[model samples]
Target: MEYQYCETDPFKRPTHLLEANPRGMVPAIREGDWASGESAVILEYLEDRDRDATHKVPLLPTDPRLKANCRLWIDHINAKIVPSYFNLLRATDRTNQSEGIDRLQIEIRALVQAADERGPYFLGADVCLVDIHFAPFVLRLPRMLSQHRHWSDPIPGTRWHMWIEALERNPHIMATTSSSELYLETFDLFMNSRLANGES
Candidate 1:
C-alpha cells in the first residue's frame, strides 16, 4: 500500500488525507473508499484480516485470557498515560510541568505494576499489543519532558529501564524510529507554537 505522510495537526490536514480518514489523524489507513481511523481500530482490523495467522505475525496472542489482558492494558495506556503526556506537553509553566511529571509517573508506575513481573516486554519475552500501544508515546514523550521540563527519568534502574531497553532492541521499534535530533526539533516546534497561541 502507498503511504502518505503529512502534518499531524488534525485541523490542518491536507485534503487527500482528510478524505482518506475524516478524523484527519496520522496512522490512518485507506484503500480506495474504505478507510479506518485510530491505531487500535486499525490494529484490530489487521488482526481480523489475518485471523487464521497464515500470513503476518499475530500481535495478539491466541490464548483468550492473554488477549483480553493485553486489551485491558492497552486501554489503561490509552486512558491514563497518553492523556498525561499531552498534559505534560501543554504545561509550559514550571508548576504545571511538575504536576504533569507527577501525574505521568503515577500512571506509569501503575502500568509497570500491572505488567508481567518476568517481563522486559509486557508479556514475558514476546512483544504484544500492550507494548505496541505504549511504544509511540513512550518513545516521544520522555524526550520532550526532559528537554522542556528538566525532567529526569522516573523509576530508573527498575522495570521501566528494562522495558525501555527491550523496546529499543526490538527490530520494528528500531526501524520505525526517527533520529533523536529530529524528534526534539519537531516536539520543540509544536511546543513553541502552542506557547505562542497561549494554549494551556
Candidate 2:
C-alpha cells in the first residue's frame, strides 16, 4: 500500500477526498472502485485482507479477547485522546488551552497505564493495531505542542515513554516519519482556522 497527503488548507480539503469519504475524515484508502475511510475500519480492512492473502504478520493479536481489547483502546484514542489533541492545538486562549491540556494529559495517562509493563510496545513485544493508530500523534505531538503551546512531556518515565522510544526506533516509523519543519508548517496553518471532521 502507498500513502499520500490530503493537500489540506484552512478552508477545505481536497475535492477527491470528499468524493471518496463523505464524512470528510481521513486515513482513507482507495483501490479502483472500492474505498474505505476512518482509521479503525481501515485497519480492520487491512488486517482481514492481509490475513486472507498471507496469513502472516498479523497486526492485531491472534487471541479473540486480545483483539477486542485492542479495539477498545483504539476507540479510546479516537474518541478521547485524538480529539483532545486537536482541541488543545486549536485553543486560542490560556484558559481553554489549559483545560485542553488537562484533558489531553488525563486521556494520555489512561493510555499509558493501559500499556503492558514490559519495555516496548503497547502489547509488549510486537507493534499492534493500537500502536499504529496512535503513532502519528506520538511522533508529531512533542514538537507541535512545544513550539505552539510550550507543552512539555507530562508522562515521562512511564510505560508510555518506553513504548515511544521503541516506536521511534522502528524502521518503518523512521522511514515514514516526516520532517519537523513540514509538520510544524502544516500545524501552524491549521492553528488559526478549522477544518471539518477531525481532519486538517
Candidate 3:
C-alpha cells in the first residue's frame, strides 16, 4: 500500500476518496482494487491480507483479548488522551490553555500506566494496530510540545517520556518520520511567530 500525500492537506489525507467510505474519514487504504477507510477497519484488512503473505507487518495480537485490549487503548487515546493534548496547543485563552494542559497531563498519566504492561510497542515487541494507529501522533508530539510553549511539560514522568525516547532512537521511525533537525527548525519558527504576536 503506497501513501500519496494529498496536496490540499499536507498531513497526507484525501477528501473525495472518503466518499467510498460511508463515514468519509481518513487513514484509508486502497488495495489492489478494493478500498477501505477508518484506521481500525483498514488495519484489520491489512492484517487479514498479510496473514499468508510475507514482507508485511502483523497487526493483530495472538490473543483475542489482547487484540481487543489494544483497540480499547487506541479508543481511549483517540477520544480522550489525544484530544486533551490537542486542546492544549490549540487553546486561545491562557486560562483555557492551562486547563487543557492539566487535562492532557491527567490523561497521559493514565495511558502511561496502562502502556507499562507492554514494552517497545503498545502490545510488546510487535507493533500492532494500535501502535500503527497512534504512531504518527505520538512521533509528532515532541515537535508539537517544543513548538508550543504552553504545551510543554504536559506529560512529565509519563510513559510517553520513555516511549518517545525509544521512538526517536528506532531506525524505522527515524527513516519514516521527520528528523530532529527538521523538528527543531519548525519549532523555532513557531516560537518566533508566537513571540512576535506577544501571545501568552
- Candidate that scores best on lDDT: 2
- lDDT tens per residue, model 1, 17-110: 7786887776787766888778899878766766775655578988999889889889999999999988887787789989998998899889
Best by TM-score: 1
| Shift in Å, residue 35, candidate 3 | 2.4
Rank by lDDT (best first): 2, 1, 3
CA lDDT, every model vs. true structure? 0.79, 0.80, 0.64
Q: What 10-residue stretch in candidate 3 is worst by lDDT?
A: 5-14
Q: Write the per-residue lDDT of candidate 2 for residues 44-86, one digit (tens) a residue.
A: 8877877866536678988999989988999999999999998
Which runs in model 1 stand beyond 4 Å of their true positions?
1-11, 53-57, 154-157, 192-200
Supply every candidate's count of residue pairs whose N, Cα or C atoms clash at under 3 angstroms. 0, 0, 0
The candidate, 2 or 3, that scores higher on lDDT is 2
TM-score of each: 0.85, 0.84, 0.69
How large an RMSD does model 3 have?
Answer: 5.6
**Lowest-scoring 10 consecutive residues by lDDT in candidate 2?**
191-200
User: Which segments of candidate 3 are over 4 A away from where they belong?
Assistant: 1-25, 54-57, 153-159, 178-200
